[model samples]
Target chain A: MKILIADDSRVMRQIVIRTLRQAGYDDHDIVEAEDGAEALAKVGSESPDLILSDWNMPNMTGIECLEALRAQGSSVPFGFVTSEGSAEMREKAANAGALFLIAKPFTEDTFKEHLDGVIA
Target chain B: MSTTDTGQRRRGSDSRPVITDLMDEDTILAVAGDAWISLVGEDEVLVPIPGEMPGDVLSSWVDVVGPWTGSVVLTTGRATAEALSRALLRESAPEVLDDEDVEDAFGEIANVVGGSIKAALPGPSGLSLPQVGHSPLVRNPADVCRVEVLWRGEPLTISVQGALPPLPVTH
Candidate 1:
């Protein structure tokens, strides 16, 4: 299995990767993109099984990337790992066809709860 | 009649709501405390007891623009920021840290804390990408909610300060 993580901040990407491991989802290949633009490009090249992305980023945003992906007819599973998890953002994410949104300050348990049925 | 339109109005004061009106010091501490444990370490704890900040300080913040326009800022000593960066990096931390590393890690901490603060406020708010440098100037004294904490015996402060200056008193 493979997962692509998109976030502008390298530190945040690393933390997301670490949290994935801590959540016991350790047996997957991971690809990284620095921003939403790169993430859009990588979706073509990498064809990842799932996407874990941050909402805000330089170039394009996570929502834009997700929109682009859907417009392109790519149905790869998608989720948000972001700082903002307000009802507004969550509704936006859901409306955009995201599987889930795991807000920041999350624990391993949070990841497990959200990624369970999606990962398999 | 001249009236500036803020996204929200204070029912009692007939003016725009300030940071203090929306949240308080305890909220700031609680928000920062959660970010610390999640990003820094599970065992890491932020002591709420105020401590004098050192001479060399750095700040990272995210601007919140909405019903309450302001910046959620985290400031600490340069060395302390680097220590936090290392902690965030964990096994990937390089032996020698660079400015970008500190900026990415420290700025992200501000981003998370700021994001939570924004959610707690009356939103439909937009959050800016994190920035790192000296702290932004406080435009309104009474519009700020600040919390001082000691993290690993080093002083750190989280301030949610309004972007606008105080409104002129009207009769």
Candidate 2:
């Protein structure tokens, strides 16, 4: 499976990639996008199996990208890897069709717990 | 009332709880401690003690706009910021660090810390992208909740300062 990680901060993108490896999901191919607009563009070109995106980003937000994808009739599995995990954001993400949210300061275990069933 | 015309009915400042009313120093410290363990390292722990800041320092922060608007700022010496960037990058860290690398890494720390702090606040707030530079000035001293901690024996400060000036004192 291929995973596309979108975050404006390069440091955060690298950390997500690192945590994925630490979670033992190292076999999948990885793609990176700097912001939500790039993420939206990549969805067309990359056709990733999974998308892990940050909530607050330049250009487009993760939720906006998700809505756009659904509007375009794309059903790619989406999740958020963001700093905030408030009930409101989670509800917003889920209503927009997010699979799950992994808050920041996450651990390998957190990734594994969220990805096991999702990732083949 | 805040959005109404004439600006006659100002939102009573008393109704909007300040940072101290919502959170205290210990809570901020706990949040920062968790971030340190995750990003900096597992064994790394922040010492809850105040230290005199050095003359030259750098700050990274993210603004929280909502019921209680403020910025979650992290300030430390330039050297310490570089050290943190290296630690965050670990094996991927370049030997020679550039200004951009420090800003990106250090700013991310603020992002995470700020995000967590936002969640702890009252609600439905918007967080701005992380910024790296001199800290935003404290607009309302009473609205600020500051915590000083030592990371790796270096002084660091996490300040949750209000973005707006104190509401007009109703006589």
Candidate 3:
């Protein structure tokens, strides 16, 4: 599966890639974008199988990106990897049609557990 | 010496345990490792300050208000700031990073760390944006509650203020 990882932090993007590899997704193609706008452009060209995005960013936030994609009728699997996982945020993400929400300080095991149900 | 003896020796001399004991060791280690890895990957090192640090290093200071109250400042040295800009651009570390670029990087780091720490804490806490400072020195002592501890070998500082009452305080 091709996955697009979007986040503003280079460290964070590397960590997510590391986690995904550790979670047995070694064969999966992983693309990266620094912010939402870049992510949208990548989405248009690459058409990834899944998207893992951060909530807060400089140009465009994850929610806005997701909404934009959905508005354009794209239905690729989507999830969030964010620091704040409040119920309100979760509800908003769900309302926006996100499949999962993974909070920060996550581990390979946790990512597997969350992604297994969706990807499997 | 045995492992127990070494552990005891390490834990005994350490007076402050709020950050060390309260949070799991692996979590802290991961954070430190990630931070160091990020900085090093960009070819930046924690260098010692030379004579007369720059004035525009730290632009602002914000109090971490919640169960714990302390101040977090954002500052950057000449080399460090330059390194940060190059890292952000995914380019090689520049010989010199512009002052504005350094300030932006400092603020961004503070924001990332502060948000991560706040999320790790037990309860909800309020975080302020990074404040830019002209002077490299942190002027207000009262704002700084606690310094980061040296866990394992790396330095980790955490400061807290008084707990908030059950109800919100009306100004």
| Fnat for the candidates in order | 0.88, 0.84, 0.07
Which residues of candidate 3, in runs, are more than 4 Å off? B1-112, B116-144, B151-154, B159-171
DockQ values per model: 0.91, 0.81, 0.15
Evaluate residue B103 in candidate 1 and report its C-alpha lDDT on the 0 to 100 scale: 99
lDDT of 2 by residue, A1-120 (tens): 999999988888988999999999999999999888999999999999999999988899988999999999999999999998999999999999999999998888999999999989
Candidate 3 lDDT by residue in tens digits, A48-103: 99999988787899999999999999998999987556566688899999998987
Q: lDDT of each prediction vs. the true structure?
A: 0.94, 0.92, 0.61
Candidate 1: stretches off by over 4 Å: B1-14
lDDT of each residue in B1-171, candidate 2, tens digit only: 244366565666537778999999988988898888888888999998889889999999999999998899999999999999999989889989999999999999999999999999988899999999999999888999999999889999999999888878753
The TM-score measured for candidate 2 stands at: 0.94
Error of 3 at B151 (Å): 4.2
Give the Å shift of residue B154 in candidate 1.
0.3
Order by DockQ, highest first = 1, 2, 3
